[model samples]
Target: MEQIFGGGIIWTIFIGFIAGLLARALKPGNDKLSFLWTIVLGVGGALLAWFVGSTLGWYKPGEPAGFIASVVGAIVLLAIYAAMRKKK
Candidate 1:
């Protein structure tokens, strides 16, 4: 199986956090997530990228996207979250 930044979940979380932060910085408007939530956003974004990328043949099984793709995934997720919250 392909690996990203090596084995285990720690590296995945680390990359996800960084990707999430970058995504927040790259996206416009305000985000009210706390530190923990931010981390969740990042990790979730990375996972999303992995799933979607793999489905689209953009990534191999067990292989996650790089920084850019991760950030893009985070941005999309953030936007969706924001929109859903706004409607509530």
Candidate 2:
């Protein structure tokens, strides 16, 4: 089952949670993201990492990034979100 999904959906969700938490912690200013948004942020981050990492030959498709990469991805997204919000 795990092989079917590579690392499985559960692993993605768990990594997303951890990445999101780390992102929130690292980001400056008070947190404004909701619970759902937090999850989205994390998952989005993971997706971003996968995309970038794969493009850079850091990882293969269906391969999940390590915790540090996930967190870094999350932080980048968070920064983008903040910038967009600031412009509004």
Candidate 3:
């Protein structure tokens, strides 16, 4: 059981990293995020997508967001992050 839980975390991290990379590549801009930040962005994006999708009935409860949706969510987060950073 421990192994399963641990593996799930590792897998989530891997997916998050991939989603972040893809979002960065697809979105046009100079995003200077570190490796860890990228992963966080991806994971955050996934969560955002999940929330939005759930609210819109696009995703059922407990269902994970799709990769494309995750990437899109990451891009949205990146845009927002950039905007906030620009305000500083």
Q: Which candidate leads in lDDT?
A: 3
Better of 1 and 3 by TM-score: 3
Candidate 3, residues 50-73, lDDT tens digits: the string is 878889998876677877888999
Off by over 4 Å in 2: 1-6
The candidate that achieves the highest TM-score relative to the unseen native structure:
3
Q: What is each predicted model's overall lDDT from 0 to 1?
A: 0.76, 0.76, 0.83
Tens-place lDDT per residue, model 1, 19-69, is 788888988989877777777887777667777888889987666566677
Clashing pairs in 3: none
Please report how far candidate 1 places residue 6 from its true position, in Å: 4.2
lDDT of 2 by residue, 12-50 (tens): 666677779889999897778877788778888777777
Candidate 3: lDDT over CA atoms? 0.83
Give all TM-scores, in the order shown.
0.84, 0.83, 0.89
TM-score of 1: 0.84
Pairs with backbone N, CA or C atoms under 3 Å apart (clashes), candidate 1? none
